[model samples]
Target: MKTADIQPFFATLKAANPSPQTELEYTSVFELLAAVLLSAQATDVGVNKATRKLFPVANTPQAILALGLESLEGYIKTIGLFRSKAKHLMETCRILVERHDGQVPDTREALEALPGVGRKTANVVLNVAFGQPTMAVDTHIFRVSNRTGLAPGKNPLEVEKQLMRRVPGDYAVDSHHWLILLGRYVCQARKPRCWECLVSSYCDYSPKTPPPQGSLR
Candidate 1:
């Protein structure tokens, strides 16, 4: 999309949902970090299902450390790569407790230093928990950025930089959530629901998908 269309594109998203939030269920910053960690190859629904059981039992770094690796694995065993994720969570908690006094650090450097926390995960925590304007370019954000011509790039890091530079300051902090939701629900990968997309008018994609037979446009 043209730079001129960027404003209204995000404006429409903001009007539709003024306050967007991550689908991952979390009551605390640490919970958010943990949920994002466990969500690498898993869906928010799956992560939430496991975290629902795990958080009540152990929500903090110290509390999670108390659960032991085996128990932690048991709690999240339903998720794919549970063993590795559990191991990473265990190590991350150890670092949080030993290095940061059991508190989730807000800095990108500190967050990325933890086990299992990559740039994407760090960006998510920094944006959602700390209200930073960092873009966590997940598959959803990456696809939406390219598909909508909002910030097309060959890779996630490239896309993230593009978004950081392109997105308006007023919508920067929450733009990640908007693009993610748009991709997840409307500008889908397999087949975009362009017929119902609210911002399709500003999108650059061609031959927008039509509504199914008997479906309302």
Candidate 2:
């Protein structure tokens, strides 16, 4: 997209949501970390549902560590790959307690060192928990970036780098949330709701999907 169009694209998003936040529910950094870890291959709503029951019992790393693998699995078994996620969480808690004093690390390197925490998860923690201007290009962000030509790339890393370089500095901090929300609710993968999209004029997607039959324009 052109530089002129880019500014308005983000401006529209900013005007729509002055302050955006992750859908995942968590009270502390530790809970946020745990929630993100469990969110892999699962919906935020699903992860939130599991964490709702899990956090009250054990929000801290040490507390979660004490839950043991079997008990922990019981709490998150509703989520896909619960067994593996439980194991990674168990090991991650152990590393946190032993290394960083049980606090979620703010640095990408230390955060990614955890078993279940990859670059994307690390980026999320850094951005949401530490208030860093990092772009964690999940499926939603990836789709929106490419579809809108805001930062098209073949993969998440490429798209992420492009976003960091292309996104206006003023909007960088919240761009991640905005793009994700746009893709999840508006520019969906199957059928984008271009008719009511706030930034549809700036999008590069061709043949924008019209409103459904019998729906008001």
Best by lDDT: 1
Q: 1-217, model 1: which lDDT tens digit per residue?
A: 8999999999999999999999999999999999999999789999999999999999999999899999999999999999999999999999999999899999999999999999999999999999999999999999999988999999999999999999999999999999989998999999999999999999999999999999966
lDDT for model 2, on a 0 to 1 scale? 0.93
Which pairs of residues collide in model 2?
Answer: none
Taking the tens digit of each residue's C-alpha lDDT, what string does model 2 give over 1-217?
7878999999999999999999999999999999999999999999999999999998998899888889999999999999999999999999999999988888999998999999999999999999999999999999999988999999999999999999999999899999999999998898899998999999899888888899889
Candidate no. 1 TM-score:
0.99
Error of 2 at 51 (Å): 0.8
